[model samples]
Target: MPGYKNPDLEYLDQQGNVVGYGEVKTVGDADQSAFNKQLAKAVKQLRVREDVEGKMDVNEIFIQVPDLVDAREVRGWFRSYQKGRLHHGSDLEKISGYHVRVYTGSGSKLADVDLGVDADGGHYDESTHTYYSSNGYSY
Candidate 1:
């Protein structure tokens, strides 16, 4: 649409269908506010677009930030935002459908940070090879 915002990256499936949308923040020192704005905009755009909303499998949203930033702090900020949004009656579908991934230098490989909201309303944050649960437990 003419007034709709565009995502930084669109992930398509083999059938040329949009499966996910991504917003990338290239500034290594960018703060959580920037990321929050980018993600909120991307989600709003994706939710309003008919083509994207029609696809049931198109639920994943990616927030790509530079690897130089602190992943732990970024995840913390995202979780906090999510909690606040959920408490304020935001759509659950949008609040819990994001993944934060970091890219190192110019490599194609993605360092995935599995930040997911579980069925029990708990947060999952994974960095590198370690995993942390929302209940102040890490293994």
Candidate 2:
């Protein structure tokens, strides 16, 4: 669908403008790198929200520290940067918003996979163990 964005949670103001939004993530604190990866996903979602809706003022990230990782070593660098699609600061501005096409080495057919939107869509290769949603579908 065109111009369609589904966010887990959305925030709006009195004028009904999209103010803030973010997705909830429950991650094990055993590894700092794993936690960082989860944080990166949230960052991208924050940009999508701002691009589709609006910007926010305050910035914050809350999470529990896993005893296995160094408490001070954990990076709290969750500053929000808006990466728009149709609006300002959108990286897709020059790409013409959904008009761009991808090509592999063959260049014969369009690529069907969009790995970026994995928070919703999930895929798994029998040869590999890249499981996104264990509850939705898994083998």
Candidate 3:
């Protein structure tokens, strides 16, 4: 703690209690080309939170992305990005927060293949998993 700077921001609960540390980062990319780089920098900016997490009532690291781009657009791009990651075996877990968004897309035809096995299945055995399409792929 002596040589490290703390996270730039503090997250507080409704009662004004410190809950965690993080940063409010903005992603200006309207396309996928810079999304990964922007995301990595945002996460790196939160590294200082490691100092107090789980030690001072700080249980998390947060990276809040401002809606510089329209929410719908950011979400659309993110969904497509996620699908791309899955298709290539990339991990999205490193990004902060639990995502409830579905990553998938419906095929042009009944037999058209997309994210998984013919737009009906994907990377793993998802026969029983509930899926919703987003950006033309299934997760």
Candidate closest to the true structure, highest TM-score: 1
lDDT of 1 by residue, 25-56 (tens): 55344567776676566556666663536643
**Which stretches in model 1 have alpha-carbon errors above 4 Å?**
1-28, 50-53, 104-129, 133-139
Model 2 misplacement above 4 A: 1-5, 14-17, 58-61, 64-70, 75-139
How many pairs of residues collide in each model?
Answer: 0, 1, 9
- Worst ten in a row by lDDT for model 3: 107-116
Look at candidate 1 and give me any clashing residue pairs: none
Tens-digit lDDT track of model 2 for 1-139: 3324565566678898666554554446545455556654655555555566555542223334344433123311111111222235445222211111112223322222122222224444445433333224321
lDDT of each: 0.54, 0.37, 0.40
Worst 10 residues of 1 by lDDT: 113-122
lDDT, candidate 3, residue 38?
51
> Where's the lowest-lDDT run of ten residues in candidate 2?
95-104
- The TM-scores, one per candidate, come to 0.57, 0.39, 0.39
Q: Could you give candidate 3's per-residue lDDT for residues 110-134 as a string of tens digits?
A: 1111211122222322563323343
